[model samples]
Target: MEHTQDNGSVVYPDVKTDYHGHPNYFRVLIYLLVLLGLSLAVFEFNLPANVAIAIVFAVAVWKIGMVIRNFMHLRYEPILIWIAVFAAVFILLAFFWGVFPDVSMVHRELAPKL
Candidate 1:
């Protein structure tokens, strides 16, 4: 919504303030806490390293999705915005993969003896 003042300048309302409905922040916090507990439990249970790592990674992704959807209000955003965000993440992943070989090999390469 826009409003015109006496001077005839158009004023736009803040998007944050124009929310139609807000998520239950307390509920979201509880969900996040539960996810944290699950992540920690993977360590406490002394599972195999591979299993533990997978569980932790899955929990981390779930927590991130919850925060992004609720706290960031991304659930209300358009599909185009979601596509853009995913594209950015894909680019970051591509960059990491491109650099991983050099980074991983650096530690293995030994200096020539004098």
Candidate 2:
């Protein structure tokens, strides 16, 4: 294949090539397996309510990281981007931490009245 370049020249072999020069079938299979494992974690584990919530949240976070790094192609993004993401995650976690106790207390108080 040939393509016109910015300098008005024809460049041969213009199509982008894979980094490894081959299809990554194994990687795709592994990603599918990981998703299956996450699904199984949700249904297979019989845990206490609080512990189940924590486990599901942790698995969701891990799956999100995998999607961001692999599917979104952000694995090689700049360190600044990683720092920003981490900062956002930390702030959100802090917010959740601050709100959870108050919410739990409110629910507990309401439980007895109902």
Best by lDDT: 1
| Model 2 TM-score (2 dp) | 0.54
- For 5-109, candidate 2 gives per-residue lDDT tens digits of 435666565246522112244674587578758756765677777887777778767777776776654664568988998999899999999988877777575
Candidate 1 residue-wise lDDT at 84:
95
**Global local distance difference test of model 2:** 0.66
- Score candidate 1 by lDDT: 0.83
lDDT values, one for every candidate? 0.83, 0.66
Clashing pairs in 2: none
TM-score of each: 0.70, 0.54
